[model samples]
Target: MSSFQNLKKSRDARRGKPRPNTSSTSGTSGPGVTNAGDGTYGMDDELASKAREVLSTALGIPLGQDEPGLEFLDDPEVEITNVSSYDSHGRKQNVSPGIDNLRSKDQVTGKGKGKVKQPQVSNEHVRKRGKDEVSHELYKSELEGSGIEVHTLPGKGRGLITKRLIKAGTIILKTPPSISALQNQHFQRVCHGCYLTMKERNIASCKNEKERYEKKMRGELKIKLNRCSGCKVLHYCSRECQLSDWPTHKHECIALQRFRKMYYKTYPTKKQDDDDLSWTQASPEPVRALARIIWKRRVEREKNGGKDGIWWKQIASLESHVSKSTQQEVMRLAQQAQHLQHYLSASIPLKGSDVDVGEDQLLPVNMEDFGFEDVQEVMNFCSSFHVNSFTLSSPSLTPIGVSNSPLMALSNHSCDPNAIVVFPNGAKYMELIAIKDIQSDEEILTSYIDLSCPYDIRQRDLKERYRFQCDCKLCEKSKNQGVDWVDPRWCVRHEGCKGGDGKGKMPVKGSKGVVSVKCDKCQEDFKVNAEEVLSVVQKGVDVLDSDEHRQLDYKTAQKALSTLIPNLQKHLPNHSYPLLSLLRLSSVSHTPPQSPKDLQIASKHIKQAYEACYEVYHQNHATPTLILCEYAKLLSLQDSEQTKMVDLSRNIAMKNTIIRNLLEAIEMLTKAVKQSEITFGKGFVVGKELEGILEGCKEEMERLKRS
Candidate 1:
């Protein structure tokens, strides 16, 4: 692809979302954590606002409008207790003791000290679980090196954070249970409805559902199901599978009916096969199960339900609401039900057969299709152990996610997180990653809510989705954090931060260490103010665009980035950090001109760039590995003509080194996978996928030998 085109593609991906209206974006979000102009942190919309109310009620604190420094003092989720309090030195601090007061021994004399009451904990506990717990477990294999043992972190809730310094595009973790279509079904547990095996058939294994369905269409076979009368959605290959799935599936079946009208009104495209999704109709116990699973018990959903956010409040549901029954309404209801089924099912994993499901071979399977077979017995044969939701892989690091599964759904959220999740088998393989560098003492945290939201939004989503308030650093920083926080107007390049510049905004520079804004024109503080940083950057870009200034742009951008990026280091240590990106970008060098003067300049810049890029990859890196392979080729091109300088510049032969480095990069990635297999548990999907990559690498090595 053309570089500009590639750039555009990169920009679009960062900007895309489920809802595209710019108006919907809140105030304090995106890049540069500055004071939000709106006064309130831009959270309180669809999910978070309601969630906050629940926190307020549970904590016995009324939630007011935005405050410059908002502090959540009490956390209703944590049990309060009276205990002997400690002072700055961990010594017992004496205080008046009452009946409920707690006491402890004094460090100096070992005497008893007065007791203290427990302060309220923040409401930021509920995080969405990963797509698959097993997958997340699987992905853990990949992160073995230690900066912070993510699983051992204190208080931050279970989530994936960094163990060591990690770069951007490092394939933080692949999907776990690297089960392919064929393999996904091979390990299924038998169904309860029937003695039949319940293997996973669909293996699109891609990010999207359609792609997974396509995979299923290739080699799918029919496993008959016993149908439900009210909603013809679920098909049980055996009665046992049907019965076993009933607890969860029924809630989905019933819930699908409520959204029938919404789909007809909202969806641009519709399909007939949508009806097949109604299979979730068999399970309803999951409704209450979901309630329990959504958030920690302390997060009260009742109060939040009656509060703001029209979309969530007006939640279209089947048991609660009555619908008009016109034929169009009926069709609409059917379509909506189908749509809900599809969406809901996507959130939850369902296995079709003990064998891989190929959509091409599937006929309209229902209760009657089984002929003499028992639905319960048959379902056991098709669905069990096949991974109803997961496509397992070795060392599958999974993404923190919200799903319909009751067991997995109980997982909670935390921004200053601990555990990481992944889907090793593309979408199918469930796994997680510890993207952030973790510490020795922190709770394993994961966010059920979307991380894309500003702190407020994230907090509220936790309350609504998982039913808890999030008072983590990301959320706590919102009030004083700044306007850029509310919307986080992202940068455009590939997954780049959409910077505040009207169009130039890239990803926001996270305050990992401290963000130092430098002026492009004057080599001083670039930010006039929080918002003015955009203008400063724009002016710099304009300066770079001019013919005379173009040559200096790289130098200026690099210098400013160095200063600006170090400030970010305190908060995070990941490639996504602006400093790292800038440093890497600074390394790109062009071909030398024929003129001797130009050639020397080119050689100097090019060599510098090469060293920087190489240093960035070091021993192990994912994207850099890909880049190195191509970059080494570029280096080889330069030294193609025999020159004494080649020896002086690079010790070994240029071609030989490039080949070695490329091979090494591939080998490192493979070994990373191998390492994950041990951590996540063997026989995982990520390891399986690595098998393919290893094979391809080996094949390429053979080709290299022949060449």
Candidate 2:
């Protein structure tokens, strides 16, 4: 998941690795600087989270200039981001940094250069696309029930599939982002926060003739009406859209209106609150971590004399433009706080169960009021109790106060999700896409990320990181074995073993299901069918260390690995542990290791492992990438006599492309990793293999180009 990759990137940043280019993203700046491990791109995962935090502040929330996270002139993700802080595009009134080649070195563009050319990359593609905002149509249509589907799903709750296949950039849903209306203001166009008029919400063209005509007169942008007495932040295009939206919102709007200024209230009646706790584990970790980041951002802003507010995103302004020195001061403080969060996440002692929330901690109030009057309450809220105010209205855009609600909180986390939620700009609107064809009544699952780690490692991280014992079917069945396996764990088990269908639906104890049949490991009266057992897979993972495997024979294990891995792969997800074992076996295919056939086999296995690993995991998954590097070394063999070839020229020609592609994959993974680092503090960085490969490739590219 991109979110996890973001977490990984944040961790990497903390580890002192350079951050990725923030300019490539929309408006926000990332917060966490953790690293991640994955299979695809080499550099992306380690820095995505910090990148997200940057963007969040950039576009999502209504923030004060003095808030902590802002005030830096340089994009945090870039190593050579020497330009006065911020992406070069929005420098006020000054001649922008026009250097294009800077982006080739992973630097944000300085704004005015023609382009940068080197061995690996020549230039960077910046976002000419506007920030993530609602198109007039999506906003208008959503209220009128445009593309929403509320159909009944089988095992999963109601499946919310798209009415049509939407384009990547198209706005799927939009509601008002966080609104900041003064107590006395009646009606005025301003930024929802600082009140930037240009940052409009969901203003799009009307497609239907009737809707178009109505909007032109008084539908969308031209509607004239009574100014909102409370937060006058809302402007309806027509009475129709307002009227259309009112049905879904009058219940909450009226409640908000009564409070006047910013307010947070608990459900007066217990009946009003429904018990939705799916994310008690995963949700709290990320949310609490984010809240802390928001505070650091706030504090940093204050030190630099820049009032800053936190939002959920990938990039943001890091310093004061007028006083560059002050920007450094702000960044220093925010960076310190960020580091502390990272360390604490890594070092803290964890308990086994969920932390209960006290009643006093559930209420919503102005952050200032909460901090000043009820410090303990604030602490409790930070620890484990509060509303989800940061949830996205659409997968991409967030509507303040609306995002944190419980209705959107019921979904659970999975390493390999059954559903995909895409919020393009990472602030407001979103579309939950079903990646594969789902069954009529299957539980709609969306993987939080690829479940490529060994079973133990996976469970440990989920429990400590996300805070939940994943009870998903896949996790449950895989629990007994060290990995998530279908019924036929061994390609073909020993003679007497008969795997039964893992699901309980099998009437006969011995009966098993196709995908997950159990082995014939029979007990006194009961036969543990691999098929039936397979249906009950475990979602959480358990971490495994060297001590546990010390007893295995390396030589014999190698032989077994070769035999079991490929067949095992046929029965499970691509990035499974068994497949990795095969790669290890293949890695040492030769005696002296100088033979051609040996290198060929090693390269083939390594490449195969990476391909499978990447297919099943995050793009920047480290294990496979590491294997790929080992493979690359073999592929780049040179005896000095006759460069006995194996697509040597092709590999050389496509050298940059391969590493560039790897870097691209890593960047995506970095986004997800950054999120994990912020919330879980797992010290994942760009996979070791990614780092090794890219550096090696860069050198190789330069060598090839020079020659």
Candidate 3:
């Protein structure tokens, strides 16, 4: 027997009904039912008539003919009884006993004598259609004035192209998400409505003066989040935000509540670690996003007669890459689809059980229609997210959630992109801004992955995650002229060859056995054991990639640098990517710097890293700008006590050195501010923060000069 059959049998047995036998062909069965040699079961005429009467009364509908068997009760799970109804004032009403109260008086009595009144159809369709039309118009208006339009490209399918000249820092497009969800790790720390972090909550609700003063000094406010009382999972900054999110949150809340109850019943002794313990592990961010999409479609179907709106049409048209998926990937998608089916089936309330008449009540629509047709459909949605979803980040470029907007996904990928997508002011809407000047009819491109890595790593990541090889201008240049000609990250300098510039270096090349590098100017060749250089570079890469090394103590940082710097300098240039990454790691690993000597050492490393970053990344790129900011901040760490000592000793040399350092720090900060304006935009939070730091550096410079 199938799982549904087993479930039905258990439910019938619990209700004190005799279990029907499949093999007994000659005997009379339970409840006036009999089985013949044929596949169909037979029921007595009198019993069949009575069953029809009961069913018609319970369903609030008249039955035309009697069925042959009890096949209607094959799935015996009772649906929740409460049904969603509407009042005259346009408010939801939960009516119990299966929508019987919705019928006219004459119809309920089975009397066709009086004129039967037809049920009133809701105007929700008209209202919803109008709203959708208005939203579509708004999107079109935004696109029309934004100087970009969707166009067909040769091989990239749909792409956004500039209609006119677009300067750097110009906002190209601002679009709201079709759907978005916070990751599991950010459920509590980030607001579900505005996507604000705990430290950036702007509503002031401090109870004491001291707390208020501290918050004011930090340019923040102490606001308590309002958590949903039902699921207790999502948190909002205010009641207004909660209300604004209710349309989507209501379904999530109900599903999460049912999921938790079912989970605890299955594992009765399982201890809850946190409030989101149950659903967080079972339904991650992607699963939750898929669930919301399903629920939204269901709502759209019921409210608008299954009309294909802009959001649904775009979502359905996204590329799933199902045909190109690997066997392991298909298996993973299938497993996720199964989990989604289990979650929805177990959580969504049935159509006629006596549950509490709250917002959790099911609509009178068919409960069997759960948006998706089968596992294949759900699997398609799961795969679509892998390609179409964007990592939603804060204004400061910190990732906070995942979002999908079909409009934004139209832009193609390029390592050397002219545009960038960002969420300005922590809002949910995405804004595409030009990072470089673009002429009319130019295709707008954005980087889907980090551009800080070398060519091989970027290619590998793009192929593995996005399932496509990059053929951008940068990639083409690197392939045509060699990686060393375009990329500075993987170059190594020769010790004895004195040709070209003094810093002339060539790309590291060769197999695992022997590594060789030839000078680009003098054609001088040097060979080394690949194991020595490659193994050390691999170690540095591992250290940089490890999560444990995100923060390291001064001792650990010193040890790592002591071992890596000498070995790397012998075979690689100071501006090599791996060397620069280690220096950056060592500089930040000191945290606040234990002593003045430690501070000076950290500053020196950061300055070196900044130089390497400037050489590697573009002048107007975010990576170099951020590195410059760090270098300036490190140099400005001289304490008041150090200045006082210099004054007391009248050390002319030390005073001059400090003054020069301050001047250099100010110049770096100024350059960083200018670069941030192009990379992060002028009005962005990062640019404003850089400006604030620049002002502080200027004040410090003047103070040192006066002293």
Candidate 4:
């Protein structure tokens, strides 16, 4: 078949519609329903049933059911080892000369100074617990390298290193969260069990309940939540998820119930709602986490007669940075502790009343009984959480919730980090994968913030938050260049300009608040202010950030992008923003381009965007892979012969160009698929989707050869 016919056939097949056979469709027999036999030709019940049965057998989907919803399951790839077993095996840290010994004498000596009271049971005591008292334990496999060791740097506390060589995209740790909580904004929207949000299903803005119901019935949505029958507050995507969360949530539910009663009594018939109680919810992220920690410690102590569990030891052992905290921070933490104490104390039923809650009910415990009066300990836990909690985000790193993963937290930071951390399975689990190769004995590092930011801002953030001066290679390089670290604004110099109106001077850098600069290379002066340029770029950024941008029509989006790009270019000449905006406007499959020329423009921007993103982000990052996939798709649209039929010689050249485009598409898709598989696990939704696209690209290549 001709390329155009092939494209048409492929499109029709994807839509589950057949091509019109002119001979068979001589008369109108209704859309896709041939009048082959009885009036029910399209409604052949027996045939339909058979098809459903086959699909059910093949996909393991129920005969009459929609696709299965998102599942947060233990990663099958990771091996679970009991912590007791690993420690007993005598396979602890391989202490090299430079590496600090795991059993350093200084560890015990240093323990007495923290604000949080050290657990009565030490790490050694917890490890010596009888096997019968311990449950099955899993360790995140950062020990893949026999050469891997934990060493305490002379000045800089504990850091990890590989004894042997490791490559980029290597799996360092695949671990679940030790403690997780949704950010206040997402508390109501996302499921506590699976972290599935209506936003993921594109139903967050459904017009009404009826629209949501209609969509669910049509098999386009599956996020029906089962509200917790007990508290009537928490919701889960399924009964299984609800059951999975019951143990921890039961206590919180009871506490919430009592808190609600106390709230009503305090307000006393005043009109109050979630808005009034918003503060209560917003402040509880860290509070709820602290409650969990306290509950675990209590349960462990009760289980082992006032002895802590192995997990509890790990949490208590985490660096609380108590000594590092200033008096102001300590005071603030004290106030926060008081606030939480007030909230918890109110949960106690007022004196004298037959409030008979039976064994079936969960009861709140008194804070004093649990030794919560050590408010300094609360401050210590909060400090640890502040310094160490990882933002559980989407695949693209959009912050959704906050979590603390013990194993994952051990990896340190570098301005030029060699590893990337991603939440592959769900927001509950964190996967730390290396993004660059390192020789044996080199440290593994990840970035705490966007590494694309200028050096000065990064340094300030690191100092204020992490309390460290980064001496990473990138920071050193920027430092050596000049004292001003880096210029936040993009250079206004044209790309091809040699400098100084044919002179040899070049524009060096543009700083914020500066008005203009002459080229250091070419001596050509420019009339541009850094603040003005930043203002223009920020306007485009605002549009992109706005909710309306997601719903804009293709034409309107294209027009807006056209206006945005020039403004962006005036500031950030190689900024990924304009290029990304163009790629999005051009590559939407639901909204096809107005013409092939639009696809051509999209392809051009794809190349530019891919380059820009590569410069700014790691090669295996999600953004670069996404750009490659879009570029490949845009090239696929140009497979028709219509472009080659312009004229004779021009036509031949066009064919050659099309052939080159196809080859390039194949190369890009292949690389993107590989990178996606590494960045996101092979079985992740994004990875599987990219694999499907790669397969399609391969088939397209085969078709091209035949043509």
Candidate 5:
């Protein structure tokens, strides 16, 4: 037989559609009817009964004798050959019991039309089938010379532990993402290949009207992105980047183009403006990541002769949390699966072979090749992505996309983590660096969420997103001792307290609608309505978060800060989280200070904000380092000329102060460089930038001394 004929025969056998009963009368010739005279009538009836029983068992729904949907089982077009069965170990297995349909003719046949002999299974391969063994081998291979090993912990399933002492600033592991994609919002601003944001490439639009005008006045060229010609959604920084990403982006490009066409066709009245691609942004990052994964698996399966490659196996090993998913999570995943199905259907080949896609426009993947029995498989993929994905970040630690690296997910979460994941080079590569010196046999842990948030907020976010309550040392310490040192949300100052020079903290606790407080030193009790304090603080936060306040001018920003800061201070602590937020806002809102007074005020606010940040986020953290860099820059801006004092004594004092400020700025910049090295990684862009600022500060100090 010809290859095409063989292919058709294989496809037919896989579908398992029964031949029609031609001998039966026309009235009884429909599906589920077998001619009484036919010798196979009883066998056909038994097969139908078994299929119905398996379907009911798999679906967990009883199929009564008079079930209305019974006719579809006998329909020739409906394929019902494969059914799920449990093995002796109670694990679900797919039982096909025939030649695999995906096999090529060469793979299926040997010389003289004989079947190809299968290879013997080895004990190693059998051992790899166990989850724990697979994880151990995968980590062993991935971290061969990195001095780390995967060990099963008592409570934690599997953790990366140090085989040798790992010093701080050491690169523990570096792995490229198996799959990564930009969020829909970053599609235009970030490169699809290198994941470099437009701003990082110095091609982004001006930040504000003033900056745009300044650039225009200077006759600077306005840079634009090179968008993918097929999709018009993904942007590239250069032709080289576009070409480099073609292997992965080609499938996505075709899918996006089809999605665009389908979208406009579905909503005829909805018009897309020239610069607006919001219609194309309907699918989120996870959907795009899942598409990439499916396409990759298809390509790999073909290359590996009908077997999934190592990449797919690595991703599949990660926990999906499907069995533990709540009803709401299941519903959400179901909706996402529906969206994925719609997207895949739009990009797949049509029913007939007569309509073939051109060489320039290939379909993303053949849906039949995916082997997804139902939408449940897609939901499982989505769940795995939600649980195992990481925030793809720039070298400066700004989030740009979502990525999945199975090797990196081995480390568990801890509030006081010893190791940290960073993309010090770029989003294409990730590095796990030790933030603290980890001794041998110490389990490597990394924070899955931001640590700067208060204790309650941190716990709530972790529970809602990751479905676990953190029992890290920091959490336990907060629970056993007091949260005041870690969370300052409820700490207030008592004016008339008899401890610490009449200045002591009044710990506030609230329940229901009332708040009670007692001074630590004075033992005085006070009561305040929760609504009166919390409501006001929440309103202030909302105002700061609003767009109107976000773009205020220096004068308007100062006025807003003046009004909000004092009110919040009256009801909250001097260094409360809300007050820290307001202080940081004050520093940024009045950038490029208009006058000496404005400069002084901005400097003061930033200094206060830095102090608060230092207390909240310890010295070696990224937050404090970032704030210290800004504070150093502000200090460098304060000079003798900016202080315009008339009196000679005051002028001399101001000059001395300027000298002191410059010296202090130099010292802070030097410290910031070191901190940046630890947090952002040695030789990272942020560390280099801090070093440059420190050098400039040293130059300024030398000029001051020479004068």
Candidate 6:
């Protein structure tokens, strides 16, 4: 039975109905009716009517008419997996068919119902459409003398070099993406055109038509998405965005619909033993990404006379690392290409009545008819994606999309990079900003991995994925000068030395694979194995990284994190995982203090976290900004206690410290805000929050004077 039918059975059982035979041959049955031949219960007319009513109400489709060929009488089944509805425009709409049906009568505002007209794309076009070309154009016209030049480095093939000295926090590159794809998992939740999260909770709501009209008059109501009335696959946040994106989305619309149909037809009906259905894990993100590239390439060709259309020549110059990729890697990409080719072949129509009925319908080429050279193009695109794609992530570092940009990809990797890439407002554009001053002709660089990771971990990651041994200055220094006390152990030397006294000691030379580490500073031989501490660290990581940990309530998660803090303190660097995790958990618990004593303890940990992160990341990084933000919050809580203090001398001293801390935090936050603007655009999400922190700081200063 279909999952929907199973759901119907479950609902009937919940309603205290007996299990229906579901296979009775009788033309009709009534409530409490039984088949005399087998003495088995069946849903009789009364129950059948109720069931149909429930299915229609819940599944949004009338019984026997859900799918085109589903026989309602043959079995008690209602396949609602791919249901759709039509809008007033005569275009098929996706789910959430009748918004009025879902909303209460009071919320059925008649405002903003005017039809949105899509605009035409303005560009030069070829007489014959859809021709591919190769060109030697390497960069955009604007980038000709933008203080940065693409240069061939010694070991690194191509990298961005400075044409002139650029100051710290300068906007080095502000380039839009060549092509970006929203993760398939986010198809329904985010607008396909503008990348805005479309969750009902996130969207604005008006109480009634009057309020909506008032908001419109006040110019407060924002433009919202209209579920596309064509293929019913995507939502556009605005008509402008829809019109701008139609060129690319048009090609994939029918193919996406057909793919969905084919996919659901073959989907399993039976429940599996392990039914883990996380969209991120199961989604075809790479496939969708490749599909966008293919369609956009075709569209660009049609519009630009096949002269390396849509500035694709810049991407063509990117290194695919074909010679560097192993056989296993090549095979994996080939398999993915084959899967997509098969899907496209099935999606494209070949005969009468099979043709897609919509704007810009599919052309007359079968993907299955693609030959070796055609498939090779896909393979080469995959190779380029493997080497050059940058993750488009939120401020908190959660990935939302995958994109490749020619300008952004030019910056090479560095462990201690002078520049950083930031995604603003969830858009696919990458902003490359200088975190430190760059001298003339100096190469622009950014870290591909987190810089706070221990040296060994960072190096391994770089080698495996980037296919290069990082000889960046930081890595080189660590290699030549011996490892820093990133991983610590209690010193046994001078029995009362306090185990390096929180200033962890470096391991002695030739200490690799040693059972015991001798502190290079104190010459103390400690009975600690690096491997054992690593094992414990991995254990803590496993717990924190588990799905169960994420689902835990705040109090429960705090308790779980508390147990790991001591182990982390004894072993890991203050700027490493242990303290970073502690700081993250503590930041979440930012309620006003219950007492002065409670506030004091929280302040101590907050200070330690700030100092630790500052030491490792320095002033120009995001971590310091985060830590300083928390510091300002802690000061706010402590500042409130000053009004209650009766001791004159203590009050004066406390006031001075509060002002001092507030000033210092303001300074750090200001730098962070500046860096944030450079990294992301001024409109970034985190920058708004930082601005809020700055406002809070200013308010606290005023409150302090009043007290």
lDDT of 2 by residue, 1-707 (tens): 33323434444444343322111101110001111111011123333243222110011212221121111121111111111111121110000011100011111111001111101100121112211132222223333554443322222222233434443223333333221111112123222222112112222233233343456577344322322222233333334434533322232233223221112132222232112221111112223333434444444565656644332111121111112224433343343233323322321112233112211111222445112234333332222111111212111111111122111112223444433332222223323334334333233333321244444544453332222344444555555543233332122233233434221111223444443333333321233345533332221010011101112333443454455545444344334443443454444433125565655555566556556555444332222333343444444342311322334465664555544544443443344334322211222121222233334435554554564
Question: Which run of 10 residues does model 4 get worst, by summed lDDT?
Answer: 23-32
- What residue pairs clash in candidate 5, if any at all? none
lDDT of 5 at 87: 10
lDDT of 4 by residue, 359-422 (tens): 1122233465654456577667656654555544444333344456555555555545666555
Candidate 1: residue 113 lDDT (0-100): 7
- If scored against the real structure, what TM-score would every candidate get? 0.32, 0.30, 0.68, 0.60, 0.68, 0.64
lDDT of 1 by residue, 311-353 (tens): 1211111011012123432332232222222233222222345
How much lDDT does each candidate structure score?
A: 0.27, 0.28, 0.51, 0.44, 0.50, 0.45
Q: By summed lDDT, which 10 consecutive residues of candidate 5 come out lowest? A: 23-32
Q: Model 5 has how many clashing residue pairs?
A: 0
Q: Could you give me the TM-score of model 2 versus the true structure?
A: 0.30
Candidate 4 TM-score versus the reference: 0.60
**Per-residue lDDT of model 3, residues 564-628, tens digit only:** 87788777766675676567656655535777877787778778777776665556544455567
lDDT ranking from best to worst?
Answer: 3, 5, 6, 4, 2, 1
State which candidate, 3 or 4, has the greater TM-score: 3
Candidate 1's TM-score: 0.32
- Where does candidate 6 stray beyond 4 Å? 1-137, 196-235, 267-283, 343-372, 395-397, 483-532, 543-560, 577-609, 626-683, 696-707
For residue 470, give model 4's deviation from the true position in Å. 1.1
lDDT of 5 by residue, 1-707 (tens): 22112212332342343321110100000001111111011112222223211100011112121111111111111111111011111111100000000000000000000111111222243234323555677656687788776655444455566668987777788877677777565676667767765434332234433454477678773334567755677877666667766666666665666556545544557786434677554555656777777777777888889787677777776656567767755765664554454455444433334233331122223345775545566667766665556655555443444566777767666656666665655666777777678776666666554343445654553454445566666676665655233345335555455663121222333434655666555566556555666666675555433311112344565677777877776766545645665665566555556677877877897788777765555455444555676677677677745444444344667557777887888888777777777765666655554555566667756765665
